[model samples]
Target chain A: DVKVTQSSRYLVKRTGEKVFLECVQDMDHENMFWYRQDPGLGLRLIYFSYDVKMKEKGDIPEGYSVSREKKERFSLILESASTNQTSMYLCASSLGGKGEQYFGPGTRLTVT
Target chain B: AQSVTQPDIHITVSEGASLELRCNYSYGATPYLFWYVQSPGQGLQLLLKYFSGDTLVQGIKGFEAEFKRSQSSFNLRKPSVHWSDAAEYFCAVWSGSSASKIIFGSGTRLSIRP
Candidate 1:
């Protein structure tokens, strides 16, 4: 079984703070993704990394950045967290071919 | 652009009752379809996927979904509802390209009554 683990399950930060959400996968998948889930809006992609040091912006990449220094770890960074940035963040990994992604337990972020 | 739509926002069913959750998608060419379930405060879990060959696909936990090309729909079904089946169900689509991103639906929250 593929196991995806996140660094934190819940987090609270003040406005304008820098926040980091980490994800690690044991499956050695080549693709990693970050998404923010909101009610009635579904899961919107924030960023994705296809390989180490290679990143692409997804539909809603504003106010967020990603790091993939290693194959097993992906980190999402909020340059300046705002109240609007509060959301349930999810991380996923998949082998490059199949489009089947395994997800980690989400981190519920609260930006006050 | 690829997109998915789960029409029902919320559904309630008694335990042991048949269950069906509607999902519609918009995409060009043959698309990759998937269904996922998310428990409260949890990440999404893959329930099933439809790539090709067969229109009907079986998924985990007695769940299944059928793909209809004419209707552009992939609706999930279960023979009987269980208390554990209560969760938010999302339908997603990918354009079949290696670099294409998968789009997810708003999701339907299922409520099981005992």
Candidate 2:
């Protein structure tokens, strides 16, 4: 089975603090994505990487950035956390950008 | 531009009652349809997918969806509802323009009543 693991399941951070959310996939998928899910708004893609050192902005990428340093590890970075940034962050991995994407259990982030 | 729509925001059904969740999408070329279920506080799980050929696709947990090109809909259905089936269902369409990007619906929450 393809497993996608996130570094933390729940996180609380203060305003203006820098935060990093890590995701690792064991399926050797070439594509990794970061999305923030909000109530009624669904999941909005923050960023996605098709390969190491490559990234693309998604619909709602204003408050977020991402890095893909290795094949298995993809990281989401919040430069300055704010209350509006509080939401559930999800990480997913796919083989070639098609088919089913394996997702981690998600990290619920709360910024105060 | 492509988009997905799940008109029903929430649904409730008694156990053993039949259920249906509607999904509609808009895209120019051939569309790749998928149904995913997200349990409480859990990640989304692939329930089924419709690429081509077969319009009726069976999925996990006794769930299935049918693709209707004319209506541009892929509706998920289950013969009987169970408490375990209570979850959020998202309908997504694979954007052909990209290699691995998908447009997801707002999601429909299913509730089960005993």
Candidate 3:
């Protein structure tokens, strides 16, 4: 089975504080993605990395940045957390151009 | 424009009843379609996918979906529902000709009635 693990299942941060969500995948997939899911809105991609040190902005990337220093891990950073940033953050990995993503358990971030 | 639409926001059904969730897309070309299920507080899981060939596709946990090109629909179905089947379902779309990012519907929350 493909295993994707997130650093934290739940996190709480105050306004203007920096927050980090880590994810690691064992499948050696070439693509990694960060998405924030909300009620009614579903999952919206925040950022994605197709290779180490390569990152692309997704639909809702304004308040978020991502890091892929290594192939097996991807990190999402909220430079300054805000109340609006509170949501369930998910990390996913997939083969290059295959489009089938394997998701981690998810990190529910509460920005207060 | 919304690439994918799941018309029903929430659907409730008895344990042994049939279920159907609607999905429609506006993409120009033949698209790759998928159904995903997310249990409470968990990440999404792939239920089924339709890339090409057959229209009717079987998925895990007694779920299935049918792809209709003319109607631009890929609706998910199940003959019988179990209490464990209550979850949020999302429909996604992508294509060889489109960008790498997949478009997902808003999602439908399924609830099982006692």
Q: RMSDs, each prediction?
A: 1.0, 0.8, 1.4
For B1-114, candidate 2 gives per-residue lDDT tens digits of 889999999999999999999999999988999999999999999999998998999999999999999999999999999999999999999987454798899999999999
Compute DockQ for each candidate against the true complex: 0.65, 0.73, 0.56
Q: Which CAPRI category fits model 3?
A: medium
Clashing pairs in 3: none
Greater lDDT among 1 and 3 belongs to 1
Displacement of residue A54 (Cα, Å) in model 3 is: 0.9
Ranking by lDDT: 2, 1, 3
What is candidate 3's lDDT per residue for A1-112, written digit by digit as tens? 9999999999999999999999999988888899999887889999989889999888899989999999999999999999999999999988777477889999999998
Q: How much is the TM-score of the A chain of model 3?
A: 0.98
lDDT per residue for candidate 1 within B1-114, as digits (tens), equals 777888899999999999999999998888799999999999999999999998999999999999999999999999999999999999999856575467889999999989
Task: Sort candidate 2 into its docking category.
Answer: medium
Off by over 4 Å in 1: none
lDDT of 3 by residue, B1-114 (tens): 439999999999999999999999988777888899999999989999988899999999999999999999999999999999999999998735222567889999999998
How far is A102's C-alpha from truth in model 2 (Å)?
1.2
- lDDT (10s digit) by residue, model 2, range A74-98: 9999999999999999999999846
Backbone-clash count (model 3): 0
